[model samples]
Target: MNTYRLQQLLYEETDIEKIQKKKHNFIIDLPKYSFNYQNGLLTLNDTSFFKKNEYLFINKHNRYAACPKHCYQFIELNYMFSGKCTEKINGEKIDLKKGDILFLNAGSKHAISSLGKNDILITFLIKEKNIKVDLLSQTKGFLNISMENITPFFTDIFRDKQYHVFRNNEPLSFEQTLNNIIYEYYFPQIYSAEIIKCNLLKFFLLTARRSEKSCPDSQLEPHNSILLSQITEEINKNFKSLTLAVIAQKLNYNKNYISNFIKNQTGKTFTELINIRRVAEANKLIKHTNYSIAQISELVGFSSKTYFYSEYKKHFDHLPSHDRQYSAAEFLKV
Candidate 1:
């Protein structure tokens, strides 16, 4: 367990007595806020309780006598690593046990009973923009559904103005993923942001796959599965010469519809998706073959060498020359 690391990052001490002693001081100066119940729901009005960060914030839930009903403008994920706690979401009571995770979307207010001294909850507060920019960018080939379809599902889980309890039935994988995230956060190295983003995506994908069984009806019905499949196949096979108009004509669909379909289904514009696949192919050639950068660029569908370099740097954070040199050094060592 990396409890010590977590303690170092989040709290001043792990001892219950010390934590209890300092708890009052922490909340004493908090801004005044109130819970407004309307339409049979409680809404927390003050948004100043949480400090904003560009990426994410990880902390332990302070041990208080009782938590007032509240919600935030950002997403919150609660994980119970030890002991247990009871929370009231909407009107239903949820008993969260060890290894249980509760995902609270934005604007969903709830209150908790007093937490036990042994109860440990790790809270993750993330901005929605961070999720879209960092996590969603790398999820190109993983799921069959588009971002448009999945966006509402996440909003429903986290921010939909409804009462929902999204928990993980199999939490072993989730536990491991969380550990990795904590480790990366506390002891960041080169490319740490990218590593953390990848792990966060993994966590979400696992949760989505697990929840699919229980909420099968929630899955977005594919609007044009056959067309999407054919289009993707075409892109994979002939991305070197592919264009939106070309695909539209070939599939007997309008160019605008084809563009929108790709964006809706893959969460990427048509050009972005093509470049992602092209850069992936370019990476392989740079690593394995003796081809020059310009040759590899042309082979991977990039017409201009400068454009290829820009895209490659955007994706890998390094140039082809750097990767080729590193590969050469490794080969010599072998």
Candidate 2:
């Protein structure tokens, strides 16, 4: 699709927006807000616009609409197609420019400021079950920095009830990938589901690359950056057999010093980091392999089955066996 067609598709007003506009009183020019709330917050339980069997829904933000404090049961990704917008995610105010992407994990509390007529924000709502898990592996090396700066949307370990913002530095390639997703989802045809998945994967990779490019090394001290990078490489490669002592011996640093540094830098202890990696790997195995829960837990370096189960449930909110079956069922249904 050409740029004009894409713009036309996104800019076309929706029925709800039209009704919202008609309800506006120009005399006072007050901001439009949704009072659909429970317990002082607007928590959406389902995709109001999604059709049956539709897991992905896309739409433009209503112009001049100011959403009140709210959260959703599914992932929400917003792209600043034009103009600018501001939002408060978990009490942090963020200013988003054109070509920016904001990923709000499920259950993250946030509120958006009113958008002007020129601001064009496109949002994609994806059910939690439909979000791909393999994206965690992509955040291993240089892209790991992306996680620290902009965070990730697809991992159970890092989905800490937070919203991540990424600037699309390479707009040409990144926007094209996003546009492909919009086109496929908006005008679905034969195999559109598969096509949209491919586009979404590409879009995520582009977001990772953009995050890497946009994140400046100056954010972290020079030595801290190098050490963090090395530490992450070791953890990613050796988490299956890794320990604080083992990592310290390999890096030729005092175990206590390395442990303290890791905790201070990442806000996670050495053991916590290892457990995060192990549980993430176990999740991947549960989705892709036939290994039993015990075997998968053992393979990821957990010694006690009970401990592994606890950690897995803590991160994923599901038992390993149940998650495997549920994942399979979700795959077949999709």
Clashes of each: 2, 0
Q: Write the per-residue lDDT of candidate 2 for residues 130-191, one digit (tens) a residue.
A: 34433333345534443323333466323444667776555335667787888877787898
Q: Which ten residues in a row have the lowest lDDT in candidate 2?
A: 25-34
Q: Return the lDDT, model 2, position 117.
A: 65
Question: Candidate 2: deviation at residue 325, Å?
Answer: 35
Alpha carbon lDDT of each predicted model = 0.70, 0.73
How big is the positional error of residue 150 in model 2, measured in Å on the Cα after superposition? 15
The local lDDT score (0 to 100) that residue 34 gets in candidate 1 is 44
Candidate 2 regions exceeding 4 Å error are 25-36, 47-53, 133-152, 156-161, 170-173, 210-334
Model 2, C-alpha of 90: deviation from truth (Å):
2.1
Which candidate has the top score in TM-score? 2
Pairs clashing within candidate 1: 105-158, 146-265
lDDT of 1 by residue, 1-334 (tens): 3667765555444454264555633232244464454443445433543444455776677664556566766677788766788887655588988777777777666776666667777777767776676555667667565444444446544332343445546533577788778778778789877888878777776766665654523444665677778887998998998999999999999999999987876657999879988998999999999999999999999999999999897666457998999899999999
Please give each candidate's TM-score.
0.51, 0.54
